[model samples]
Target: MSTVEVILQSCLSKPAGNSLLVEQYVSDTASGRRYLLGRNEHAAEIMQMIEVDGIIDDFATNGTTWNNKPVLTTEQLPDQSMVVNCAMCIAPVSAARRLQKHGAIEILSLAELCSHLPQRFKLPWFVSQTRDEIRNHLSAWNSLSTALVDKQSQQTLNDLLHFRLSGDYHYMSGYSVRPEEQYFEPFIEPSAAHVFVDGGGYDGDTTEQFCHRYPGYRQVYLFEPTPTNLANARRRLKHQRNITFIAQGLSDQQGSLPFDTEAGSASAVDPQSSQQIQVTTLDQAVSEPISFIKMDLEGWELQALQGARIHIQDDRPSLAIAVYHQAADFRRIFDYVTGLYPDYQVYLRHYTEGWSETIMYFIPANIKQN
Candidate 1:
């Protein structure tokens, strides 16, 4: 296809109707980059792509820290009240809420930021489905979006898609989801004790939440590949006996591949890294029955589902797969899962501030019969 066909000029962010949103952006941008909140390497890329004029004020260093810019730690953060939230993937929700309690205005989102910049997210990746794979992927999204059962589910899916295709957070207005709620979505009654597969089990946070939410689980399979992370998860759930720590990553195949970003919980299978790690398909690795599966495997949700096809087809376990890791995943994983088990009730829930933790739940129609 030609470049003109690939480019989505029609869907680009317009600046005419969004004057109210970027009133602060015009004034504040002149002084300097007041506060760029993105902390990871992604934030670094944003900084590099578009020059950040001022300090990168972020104390919470979970992943790889910034190098080029002057990073102000905790003490200096008090002085810098964030006038503009420059596309922080996960907004500082708690702090924003706290400030709101004391009568501060709500923070801006990527959509609000889009009013100032030339772009919101990546260009026309959605409409550029000229290739067979992309065409199929787009078809899956359209199919699932239409056949989504509930109106709310469909809207949520669209809203998340809107944010992904264009970095707009309008759909996220007046919504807050607790972490416990992320795994245990409403509308479906979860059995008190059930077999659980916790994919991308980072530092036992979800495991701890799962224990509280569904106490006395029959069994739990916690999958984490990085050595340091596995050790951390082990240490966190050391006292628990029902927990089974699988020291490998999940994918469509069972073999070794180079894992990326081995720094704590952010590690995932990436081509850039040469560090080799063992990865196995769920069908080949898991022997017992699975009642529920929650995958947040970076961007490998679809591939993992393919590996676990046999299990899903047989057991029809409730799924809480992360779809916000990439745009197509929203449809690809959901389509495949529901296609495997047609009677499942689907629900969309956004766990984080933006499109990061948008989890798609698929519960079997006869879940109570389990």
Candidate 2:
């Protein structure tokens, strides 16, 4: 297990009376970068996972703190201060309760540092082109989005419109999943035996929902590399008879790979990154009837899918993939899937309003012949 994993296991193994929730994020500044730690009941868990004083002291020693930027550390955080972002939303305070009360953060530009936060997350992103830049990008995206939108496209638009208006139909409430059956149901019905390969299964929520709804499935296999996520997935599915959880990650090759980030967040084995883990391909590791596959790998969707080419061609399972990670991923994944199985009907939908896009795939009732 990785260092983070060990700490997470220790956290989860604690007594039931203990309730803790800790979150970490990156705080970038002109001088340097520092880690932001947030805690509720589980402040101790955060302490166990990180070198608290060390990390804080590093930033302090570098003189990165006490900046004009709006970030709240353990010492510097204000009780009710606001943090602004220049990219997605305006007045994006580091609190969700505030976000729910207020909708849409104002978009600011790098040049408008005086107007908004001085810097935006300068990471490689799919929708990096600001809202102002969308018009220029639309022309390039036209062909790709057009191709991805199938017959259900119109209905999806209608549903999305309704959802935006009233947060119904397309949205889910709590643990209860709203059943509109947009496009993923067709492929799941007829399979005599089914196996679901959940690549980025977090806390096993999706897998639990799948098993709860479809209890007769052969097995649900989960590949979560992070020790925290993997342990939680195991704990969640411990009572289930038809589930197998693995600590290894699914990648294009077989070897130890860095996860690149903290546990339970975005993980990768791209060699160039920091945190990594052992990798294995689906074809080499799996030996069952994989009827459905769901991938939410931060940006490694293509690599993970490519590793499952044999399964994609042979099983042709329904896919729930996050296509908003990379700009070309929408087109790239569509082309890759359709190129192998031309008859498979593709249906796309963006589940959340912001963040990223969740695209779904539905195979035709039967294989189409040329």
Candidate 3:
């Protein structure tokens, strides 16, 4: 008999709704791996009467089995006709789209299971933004959880997550694009006249937001590696005279690096690609006391940090580093900053749905941040 049959046989007397289990994240090094192990066992029991067939995940681990059943990858999910999709809370939009294409009857997660299930399974953590108790509970997932942030910042993260997941921002702060993210963060001021650097300045949308937030910056250095993006950014910022444009990649070193251009605004230097782009270190590019930096280098955040180490250490500019490219980045980026600038306190903010666009904000704890 197939694995699906066995699961169905085990639930012979249960309700007959079909189910598909999707593990949104599976990390081999972090707690995610262990959580995956538990989810593997939990997949069979929906905490509801719905019948479960098999498990699916995009993490795509090899040579792994759950309850002696082969844990299927996202690619393998369609083969088994599934009805309900029990996915990670706030899975990427792409994944949801793929599952929709496959005709998943319903998409649910641990946090949402209670809403669908007859009884709430004693899940480790449930998510609820409407209630501070649940929000505060799950906010402890990291040192930079929502519970630790200011009430406004906490509301901002929760509201952004809600909008990302459900297309609703009723609870969000007025600012959709957080140019000066820590605007709610007190006692922090822009250093000097403000030498703002916009990494991956696609079409200058962020630049526009930055200007709107604080129009008095001395100079704005905009970097867009692609010919296409640079042209559009130039057109967008044509009237803005205080801006300098660089048509190259930013990296940890001042040298050429390979890049994948097909990814659009997320394009970055790739060592294996045949393509090449001029790349430079921010430290090598500028000598002034830096004030604010905003980087969305796709997956090159860490390398870019290495490039700006001196500026960050000496000038102590307010940092907004993107840390969602790789799961390791979530922790590694924070560690890198804290190791270099121990005086700085690290906080995290997540934007976008699924598992993308999580920004880590590092501010000097010496300031009055309540």
Candidate 4:
């Protein structure tokens, strides 16, 4: 039976809707057997019963079972209720507590978790709602027993959003772009304080897109380190009087380092990849006010953010950062950025509608004033 089913069965013998006392029996690599004693009122309720305040222990002293009997000794349970010793049954509960401790598992906040959410989620509000829903539904699955399933579902959601936003799908136009994202009327306009910073100006695809839709952008700054990409960006934007191209990669440190170019998207200034290149610091770039920044610099996001401390603090511009390159991208980047700028209203969005692209949006709390 499923872990939830067994837990519910164990609690249903007496009460059907209150918390019940539940203990666990677990084995360790060093200790032959061990017991995890605790009280979980919430889990008990989820298991369909209320746990009375009582001591529950797992005393499986014997090393093995006998006559098809469990080796662990335990206090007598309520009459008509069988002892629950299934490792699979209690595994999920154990994991749930651990994930909660690490601050990695939780249902979305009530306001964030709206009702009647669209199942076939798309961009803008739909994207935010879908992720919040997944986190809420799978909060219990973040533990070891169901971690694999939880991770797989997370990946699938990431991919679905990526594919929808990559701007390659034929159906992209049919989804009804957000008013802020529309090419005109409501699209982001350029201002004297506005300077577009492209962290990974790969052949200036972003530049071309920006210029095509919002060419009046006050000043365009492209950061491309690859010889091929740098040359292309230079050729493409050379005629634009407001555009400036930099042949450097931003990193945590302000020094040159090797970058793995072979992995392509996996390229890094560290040993994580095969190709290598010298890196620069964002501090070395423009000192003027920047209105918007788009980062697609592989997995060097943390280090890049560090180097841009001055820019972020001084400019306080809008950010569209790619977070798919690293495993803990969501937690690390989101917490770090938002923690530093508490007043900024951070919005998560995936522009790539594919398997592993997750782009996040960061705007000052007063972004709507613009």
Predicted model with the maximum TM-score: 1
- Give the candidate number with the greatest lDDT: 1
Per-residue lDDT of model 1, residues 33-76, tens digit only? 34555454445544555555433344444333455555553334
Worst 10 residues of 2 by lDDT: 17-26
Better of 1 and 3 by TM-score: 1
Model 3 regions lying over 4 Å from their true place: 1-193, 366-370
Return the TM-score for candidate 1, rounded to 2 decimals. Answer: 0.76
Question: On a 0 to 1 TM-score scale, where does candidate 3 land against the true structure?
Answer: 0.57
C-alpha TM-scores of all predictions: 0.76, 0.59, 0.57, 0.50
Residues 1-370 of candidate 2: C-alpha lDDT, one tens digit per residue? 4322332333223321101111112122231322332221122232333332212111243345322322333344333222222122111122222323333222111122211221432211222332223234435334444554465653453333222222111121111222233224544453522787888876787788777667777887888888887888889888887788877777777887766646345555456667667778887889865777878787787888888889888877777776756545655777777777776666766544333445656554474311
Each candidate: RMSD:
5.8, 14.3, 13.6, 18.8
The order by descending lDDT is 1, 3, 2, 4
Residue pairs with backbone atoms closer than 3 Å in model 3 (clashes):
91-354, 92-354, 258-270, 259-270
Shift of residue 331 alpha carbon in model 4, Å: 1.3
lDDT tens digits, residue span 1-370, model 4: 5443333333223221111222211111232222222223322321232222222234344454332323332333232222221111123233223323434212111111111122321223323443443344333323212322234334433333332222122222223223234112222334422578888887776777777666566788888888787887778777666888888898877667767665443455666555566677776777777788778787788888888888777767777777666434655666667666756654444332222345556666554322
lDDT winner between candidates 2 and 3: 3
Off by over 4 Å in 2: 1-143, 149-193, 261-263, 270-274, 365-370
Error of 4 at 271 (Å): 1.0
Ranking by TM-score: 1, 2, 3, 4
- Can you give the lDDT of residue 167 in candidate 4? 15
